[model samples]
Target chain A: EPEVTQTPSHQVTQMGQEVILRCVPISNHLYFYWYRQILGQKVEFLVSFYNNEISEKSEIFDDQFSVERPDGSNFTLKIRSTKLEDSAMYFCASKFNTNTGELFFGEGSRLTVL
Target chain B: AQRVTQPEKLLSVFKGAPVELKCNYSYSGSPELFWYVQYSRQRLQLLLRHISRESIKGFTADLNKGETSFHLKKPFAQEEDSAMYYCALSGQGLTGGGNKLTFGTGTQLKVEL
Candidate 1:
């Protein structure tokens, strides 16, 4: 089965540095999403994207966060000026349609900010 | 605000024992509930959705609106059933196509031999 794929399985960056987490959703899937889980915390939704634009975002997705579908196959999340609290495993997910609640998830990209 | 709660951080059971992973939600609107599973080194996958009212891999969950809970259960556990289970909730606001999921802290199930 086709699945979502994330790059840089793990990344370590210094505080105040820019970090880009990349994902390639299923080819036919239209909607994409970004979620992150701080160690020992629940997975939190960051942003959702569709039609090449952001559909919704949570408070955690502040000015420091941005998402883009730079191409037909790539969806990327950029975090500017990383912080210690930003260390978490970020997941990318996608689903073919909203009518079906099944969303495919990637293995996740672990980000560690020092 | 929508919230999902999986009380137990870990639930360990022997193979063939009945298993239950509890999940509760706090959502004002009518919500969609789902159970997702993640085995070691694997991606998260949908296990059950309350709307479907079906069982997958011998796992089942029912949405109790009155209790605001959607707990996952299985009749007999197998070693392979061990995994990290997450209960998630989404608001009924399905606009153009982004149903944001709010997940619980998750319950780790270990089906031991």
Candidate 2:
């Protein structure tokens, strides 16, 4: 079965440095989302992308955060300057349609900021 | 704002015992709720949803609006049921904008022999 795939399963970056996490959602899926789970915290929604633009974002997804579907297949989340609090495991998920309400999730990329 | 609360951080039970993972949500509008499970080293997978109202893997959950809860329950827990379970809600409707999910802190269930 087709699944969402993420690159750089783990990334270590320094504070004030830029970081980018990449994801390739299921080919036929339309809606994509980025969620992050801080160590021992609940999974928090960052942003949701559909039809080429972000539809909604959480407060955590502030000025430093950006998302793009640069190509038909790749969805990426970039943080301009990493902070110690930014260390978390980010998961990418996709849905085939709006009605199903089931999201297929990727393995997740663990980002560590020091 | 939408928020999900999973009261228990961890739950331990013996094999063949009944299991219930508590989940509660605070949402103003009609809620769309779901249960997701993550096994050791595996990606999060949908276990069931309130909309479907169907049982999967011998587990079931009923949405109780009056109680503002959607708890996952299994009659006889198997050892393989050990996993982390999360309850989520999408307060927004499906059509207009991105349906971002608000998830609860997961409950780690350990089913031992």
Best by DockQ: 1
Off by over 4 Å in 2: B93-95
User: What's the CA error at residue A77 for candidate 1, in Å?
Assistant: 0.4
| Model 1 accuracy (lDDT, Cα) | 0.93
Candidate 2 lDDT, tens digit per residue, A15-98? 999999999999999999999999999899999988998888889999999999998999999999999999999999999777
Label model 2 with its docking quality class: medium
Model 2 RMSD in Å is 1.2
lDDT of model 2 at position A58: 86
Largest TM-score belongs to which candidate?
Answer: 2
Reference-based lDDT, residue B50, model 2: 96
Candidate 2 chain A worst ten-residue window by lDDT: A95-104
Residues B39-96, candidate 1, lDDT per residue (tens digit)?
9999889988999999999999999999998999999999999999999997854478
TM-score of chain A of 1: 0.98
Q: Which stretches of candidate 1 lie over 4 Å from their true place?
A: none
Lowest lDDT 10-residue stretch of candidate 1 chain B: B90-99
